[model samples]
Target: MRKLDEAHLCESVGDSTSTYFMKDQKSVTGLYTERQKNHFLVHSVACLGTEMHLAACPLEFNKGNATASCPGGVLPAVVSCIPGPLYTHSLALKKKLKTTTSVRLKGGTHQGEGRVEVLRGSEWGTVCDDRWNLQAASVVCRELGFGSAKEALTGARMGQGVGPIHMNEVQCSGQERSIWNCRFKNITSEDCQHTEDASVRCNTPYMGFHKMVRITGGRSQYEGRVEVLSLDVNRTQRWGLLCGEGWSTREAMVVCRQLGLGYANHGLQETWYWDGSNVTDMAWSGVKCVGDELALSQCQRHKVFSCQKTATRFAAGVICSETASDLVLNAPLVQQTVYIEDRPLHMLYCAAEEDCLSKSAAKANWPYGHRRLLRFSSEIRNIGRADFKPKAGRHSWVWHACHGHYHSMDIFTHYDLLSLNGSKVAEGHKASFCLEDSECQDGVAKRYECANFGDQGITVGCWDLYRHDIDCQWVDITDVKPGNYIFQVVINPNFEVAESDFTNNAMKCNCKYDGHRIWLHNCHIGDAFSEEAERKFEKYPGQLNNQITRK
Candidate 1:
């Protein structure tokens, strides 16, 4: 009984199975069902005609059965259809429909913040900064998935744009979705010039090469030592320390943004407070930034770099804001792919060395028991505005001969099968996962991959999907008996990495087992529901579980 736009609808049903119906009827009808034993069914009908308003009555059905059924047989639902055709065609059929135009930022090294340009009739054009403002610039920022405009620049601040100046006197109310929706004047050759080309510094999401950097060694989350991961000519990912020489607030600002933290309160060239880790190899020196760039690589550096202080004590450090990095589990995939498999103990030597098995496994006889593993596909998405990189460098990454891939972080994700009272019965852990773009949104390309030891990290608008068949993606539940339990998955369990919001990081599902086959339902994002609803979800034992709720 609610209206939804295409974008919101896609997000809501993204993890669920859905069906769409399109018919040449006067009205469109829909039926929705809630996931509960005694649920409500609301039926709605709307007009199919474009630009026509129609009102339909909502019919509510009260049912005792879990599945929806028509008790009184098929009811003839009627709606107040407007007296008009489905679509209205103008008499001037010769007029062509407006073709879609494209926008891009040039000159700047990063995406979202750059010189303004438009694509028209297969030709790229520019915008004249006659009356450009933050309002107009924000429209472009929003269209590019950035937050808003931080600054609306003019006089070729990001360098002059080439080709025709197609727009001038641009104005926006700041609420428009795109620059095309705003009011602007079409320009001729004499109306405007490239010297006045408009540029925008958008409050864009932290992305690109900046994702490969991390901060460590500080006492608090805000204050930390600095490190970076880079790819060598050999295609091997390596992590090394940074020389603190010439490090300033400008460089710290980029670091804070890359880590999803706010602006830098203090950038330190030398810090003896946090030298706990063994990472002392200096890989960069003479690092400089403009305080506006997204990544350190975008900053200026000396052609031939060397560090005066070879010690890690002189490494770069920064005190950033409290807010950074947020990780969340893919709830839909857990419910759909959860299954059980039996693995031999003889084949678990690498897992044992990695401490993936429980402490009890150490005391058991060598290669004795068959571990009943609860396996499922997990898609850990970096939904926050910034990328999530491992805090450790490649020197510390563990290479598993059996897996043939390096583990980047010591502890990345935690999986557990807990009793109703919150008692843990079985557990699993994923160590130092390699980040890659399993999928990305339109206009974005897959950059990082684990293949060839490439740079590994999750970029904004990208996700790292671990299939159900992958090694160590399961809980060793060989000891648990047949009963009701809660299946919980927590991403970035250790506070080693920072995130913007940590509330949505945990996902839980209701599970039922009977020695052989198992069923998981009611899977949902941890913070999506209220505390009371979560308490109810955890309290109820899965004796007669039948519905999967979508919140």
Candidate 2:
């Protein structure tokens, strides 16, 4: 390689003939030149960008010509051909939404990290991790409205997927418009599994959105009263409380996303408990969002701020988390174990002591009459990135004499029977007395145990079992009439624990009851069906209590 002459370099390098020297794959604008060592001069070279080899282009070597030969001060030519789309930063990329075609990301806790999936025909499939690289991942990120990829994850780092393997051994020049534009091999049955799925972590642009707002007060940075930057009458920048009226999880979702927090654990209507900040004026009001906006400003808000609750305590607040546990029930196990039990009052001493029976049970004949109970085993699994832990630690755990155990969370799960219109017919709640890993996936060691007052939690990939025979695990249905009902179980019903996804936390089953016996069927996760399918499944035109607000 030889250097071009500085004097004539400008005229020679960027000439009309230089188009042949540039990689002209649409994104290429022009050649950018730089200096290099060990220079050799070449004249009249035409590459046309698609040459299989440098020898294919017409070129002449300056063997003995003094003018064409490298001078002592001259340097070799080095071109840093940057793509046209990349000249501008991410703000420019957001101006034009790039079409993703068939590629999609899945199972990611955050926005830019996920297992790569591609839609072929009507089927969605994963990409094999074979020969996956940052260049290929960058192509994916850029196509999906994000910046260059930060990491090319392999071996299902995000999580395994269930589908056919679409592509493998993908090769990219790091400038392709889409992953499909890159060279890839066809996948075979023996080639890969869901465990070998490819994933990517993208480098998102810093929007400084977090700086525009902040959470003040609360025990940690994740929980606080919401405050936004506003201009006062004097045109001075000030931080003021956000109005809490009509604020819900949807609004908080936008706030959490804007702050770069993982998710909204709770959208508190009032934050009087967190009094860390002195700012008291209600600066913004009438904020409502569909919930997918990147920032709070993007959501619909009032043109003129009007707040009914002007008190500082009435200010909006939020609890955010980077990672949270998601608990899903074993629906099949529940269906298999559901049964009705009529227990005599003599055996109800322990049940009555624990307050597990219905309210009407208090007036029942002592040690004589029997109470009808609906029993079912619940296998609550933590399928999230983090363990399902109690919000309160061990020091605050309350000891229960009857069960001979310490209850952690006030209420962990809700068991309810609902009519077709979404009205609750009966209800039962399980206080988290012993939240420990009763079972774990193969090769995964259990991290939580209830024995000897050990730490209590449902580790990721583990489940805590509450048997049907357990004292407080039954719903009292003695006063109920025989009819068709929806048996619903909601884990973490109060949002006491942070979770990556709360949508899948509920399981519903269709229950049929007669005067003598009960039947349960069609048990499944709440989000197991599509929106259209779910609407058809419930039949009744009422909002499901288990659904989380999403865009």
Candidate 3:
């Protein structure tokens, strides 16, 4: 997510009715678990699923311990319910939804995941991955009577299809019931290939997967230390902690999915601060996943109980969210506008004040030396549903005496030059002095402006552009040796803001420096290519550095 500051993103929650009916797993019940001193044990609770809240159910609390209220294997109530779809498309698209005979999914392992194919006339075709996103994929999901998309895959992730490419650059508002109701570009033969076919994983019916695992000691329902319920050799059920060692976002993603949480904002490896759970037995360890698993138990793990740290403070935890912003840099723009500028120190007063130049500049003669700056334009687009707002409000914005503007965020972006092994050679940053809508789509009116101390934020369908001429937009590479390197631009590098997908927040380009000049090529988003292609890119040989950079 291209966020303005190092803080968790937040959105206001409004009262709304849930779309699906849900029930807990019988194996794990409320009455069987450990309880706090002040916690109540409600008994004989019964009500139809249609009730808005548990308060509507006939409930009675135990006067003492849980054993006194419930006995004879009478654990907490285990309900059986057939859940409906978690979401539906807009009612305004009712008429268009009926005409969804055009689109279909294929080659899926399950019902709601597959390569998206559309019918052009009577012949089935596929969609190009260009500009394909969750918004457009959600439309197709709802059209197929499923919930919103869990993943909008690209580059034929579900497998390639053989047919004409019917659509390119699909743009949907996510409210449309069908992909046909959204704006799109007609595909040209040269515009797309079968290799770029789009695919999706839509949200399916509730399966009570969340009941098997849970988060405890979080400030909200979306965050906490992870605990899983599993049976021992004697078939006795117990809840235990997952080892924090080697835990990462991929593991967190599976946990969130299993828990019916939207997405994993953070895969925290430590839970020392969350004091809610006293369970300290490390039941699992060495869990590794590719991030598409439906359950944590399905992930690869060590056969024996093993952990570097067995303490409860080292338990795996997660912070989940229903929505988050996603930021993508304009790769083509970065390639088209990259150049070197030997800026005189006298003219870099503002840049110096902002600490944009390399640290070696401090030892140079007063306003005499020229700093070789690698300049490029950065265009950050918020592709997520949530607006990208500054974590700190106006009251906390820091004023910059030199720039004569308020710095809304401490660090908005990071521009770096990295070696082949991914060690940083040099770096620069764009402090968010002004974050406003630099431009918007055709129908998206500008909602943020930096002029006259106006509201600052990048709304959906809008972008914030930092031109090459702007101060602090370039990495100072004067002290570095000229050789092959990677030019990487990381948005929200600190993960300060919550984003739907942090994997795509980085844009990288192959760079070759030859003392006097620099060349950049193959600039693309981090997740734009396949794993194999990315591996080859990372291991790119030095011999290939002689080629002319693409314009």
Candidate 4:
């Protein structure tokens, strides 16, 4: 039995429904001991209330080669779901959310210095700044648990700037452009622009996501996939992929011509007969095949010193090929198996991996690590709510008291790389939206009305990304294909709004209000700052809309 590896990723049977139908071993239901001394005492719950039919309980050893003693062996009443140290979750009150100093509230400031919402129980409620001073800022900062009072802000709301803006006069020793800006509030707004109302933002540092590759080997790992071409079944695929200069048996060289390697265009061609007669890895042009009964095995071994593919045929050998396990080499018909071994080898970057010498090689998109949380330093305008009333279809108006939709650098990868020359933005858009969709609604943002919502069979681009709201769980990524990237795109975040949000069509039907379009000439990651921010913005946000860890 092989031990579980990190790559052996598994999702927990998260819900009661799944757990109810599942076997006990799939989860650690209740803690079990080695033995049970007092059967009456152990089985007797609440004394007299205990059910008598102890034998009927589903109390049995979960798996083979494992056992618990008698009374000590009995299972506990609850699960032992402690991952690390048994640290119990506690309620923490903190006020680290503060906006930068440069910008100020544009209008009304009639309340205290500023207003803030605190997490009380399960709800977020506003806190009144009665003291309204440096002390108050300290309380807010300490409440948040970031550190001492960095600064305090007055006037506008920090987050969505919805509901009401309370808290009047406030002043703090905290620096300018911080949450400690005012000790008192001279402005007021039922719900106003970000400048007039506070947009409580906190400076969370940058964290980037990078795939971790642990296993690198020279030997090929066989993976089976079905390829659809101009014809349904054309067992033949033309191949040509050369190991870049210094890679072959020769020393360093810039170009292929620099080395004595043969055939440049048609780098290398490998043929595999699916007919069961010769479809073995050991028999492949560049590799040695493996067979059953090692003692009697006649398979020949080929040392792939340094060569590329030229041309190849796909034929099947033996009636039933000696194949690997279900994960890697399971073929359409077990008979259609292809041979690939996992020997140490250097992995190639996408540009190179695209052309593997193995004709049967198929690629998968790498898993993007996790996302870092950061605040957007922005000057937001006031917008009234969208008196949303469900329309004929399953669509409804999105009443955003103050919502300015924005887009990010939306990077998407497929399990299998999409065709470069001819892939649509729609497919990529679907993948991006599927991963990025924070709302979880069937139709978020009107089903990609934007020109770049990603078209089918076409290369995907940035304009295609939807405004995914918060921490997104790519939980089940059946939509993702692992392999080389189809390409990349960066849509102008501001200008692409009306195009992206379905529930939001410029009410009067115009985009003059799209303020930043002037700064973003062509929807590419504009400046160094924006580029850095784009890289930091993650698919997921913190649970409490709190700050993400700064890497």
Best by lDDT: 2
Each model's TM-score, in the order given?
0.46, 0.65, 0.56, 0.18
lDDT for each residue of candidate 4 in 1-551, tens digit (9 for 90 to 100): 22211111011212221111111222332223311212212222221111112232223332433223223334323222211111112223112223322222211111111235432222222333334444445434332322233244543233223222344444554432244344555334532333343322221111110111010111221111111111113554322222222121111010111111111111112223222122122112232222111110122323343434322232111111111000011011111211112211233222123222222123333232221111111111112111111111213212212222222223222111123333421121111222121121122242223233222111111111222222121111123333322222222121211111111111000001111110111111111112223233222111212322211
The C-alpha local distance difference test score for the whole of candidate 2 amounts to 0.74
The models' CA-based lDDT, in order, is 0.67, 0.74, 0.74, 0.22
**Clash tally, candidates in order:** 7, 7, 0, 124
Models ranked on lDDT = 2, 3, 1, 4
Error of 4 at 443 (Å): 27
Across residues 152-229, which tens digit of lDDT does each residue of candidate 1 receive? 999766655434677889888766656877888988878877668898976643234555888877787667888888
Q: Write down the TM-score for model 3.
A: 0.56
Q: Give the per-residue lDDT of model 3 (tens digit) for 87-130.
A: 22355555434545668775454557778987654345789999
Worst 10 residues of 3 by lDDT: 6-15
The segments of candidate 1 whose C-alpha lies over 4 angstroms from its true place after superposition are 1-270, 273-325, 363-369, 541-551
Question: Whose TM-score is greatest here?
Answer: 2
